[model samples]
Target: MSRPPRHDEATLLDAAVRLAAAGGPAAVTMSAVARESGAPNGSVYHRFPQRSALLAELWLRTLGEFHDACLPVFAEHAEPHLAAGAAARQVVAWSRAHRERAVVLLHGVEAFGRAEWPAAQLRRERQAARRVRQAVTGLAERLGAETPLDLDRVSLAVVGLPLAVVRRHLHAGTPLPGHAEELAERGAIDLLRGGGS
Candidate 1:
């Protein structure tokens, strides 16, 4: 019989996230994660070769959760307008539910040093970008707007507007209002309808 490893990868990452949340990314060194997680330093290195890898994993993991929560709305709804609203709502809703994760995500690549991320992590980021583009394009066509939908406008609607709602509360270290999701939904619909610009 074999004994299971005491400090798993998720444990170390969780420690990293907490450290990052508490003291920012600068506080997330391997030694620090080990101490924070009560794991051996060797275990931290086994899961992540360097601090950059840890930062990359932290970034990718949080964004992955965001995409998982948000993308299904786009895939499931037939009405582009409703789908747009739902996606926006989902963004704020997810952020509100995962406040610490939201804070990390709101910091973005600047906190993680995008240039230092490994190639595989960069590819995942690119794939996420592609998916967002495809969803936006498809939704624009479904809406049948008179003007062609550019990436910028769609971004403003789907990501920028919703993010604004989330950022205000997250930055202030306050809980978001219960109506945040609904407000985001309306903002996204208006932006999509070409009335919010």
Candidate 2:
């Protein structure tokens, strides 16, 4: 009997991510991933039934990676407000470091309406968003101030900020540098300290 070839789901995912990062999410398809990974199309489909599934997995994995990168920043600071600032800084830094993946993640959100993602995934996305919004509001309150922070509005804005930053860089096909976190932190601090007008 012949032994079957070993296949790594992670190895296949990395290829999909690289393709999406290079030429936008459109570049990622089962065929493209199989070609990139030097794997058979049957092998790829055996793992992810459709391109959407692969893309969804890639999105979550990349987003989770970026979130993990900020965990230490959150842990290191005792003050909730300062920690938020620090988190923002680290997030922006991560966005800069992972520009291509960041763009893929950002554009994924916009393409979402068109993609018609799985309902379960959309709900999970909403829930994860709620957690982040709660954290921000909690930080503001803990810092001895109240925030008129509408989680819906702020969460959407905060999530989209990285996209704006990333698009400016990618579309220009050049370096675009700015400290968005500083602006966000200062704005946040001012609002929490003096309530939003």
Predicted structure 1, TM vs. truth: 0.90
Q: Count the backbone clashes (under 3 Å) in each candidate.
A: 0, 0
Q: After superposition, how far is residue 138 of candidate 1 from its true place, in Å?
A: 2.1
Where does candidate 2 stray beyond 4 Å? 1-6, 110-115, 144-166, 176-197
In model 2, the Cα lDDT at residue 10 comes to: 85
lDDT of 2 at 139: 53
Q: What's the CA RMSD of model 2 in angstroms?
A: 4.1
- lDDT tens digits, residues 1-197, model 1? 98877898888888888888778788889999999999989999999998888999998888888888888787678877788888899999899888888888888777788898889988988887798778777766666644554546766777889999989888888889989999999988887676532
Query: 73-123 in candidate 2: lDDT tens per residue?
Result: 655678655565566566667777877666666675545233666766666
Which one is best on lDDT? 1
CA shift at 14, candidate 2, in angstroms?
A: 1.5
TM-score of each: 0.90, 0.73
Q: Could you tell me the lDDT of residue 8 within candidate 1?
A: 84
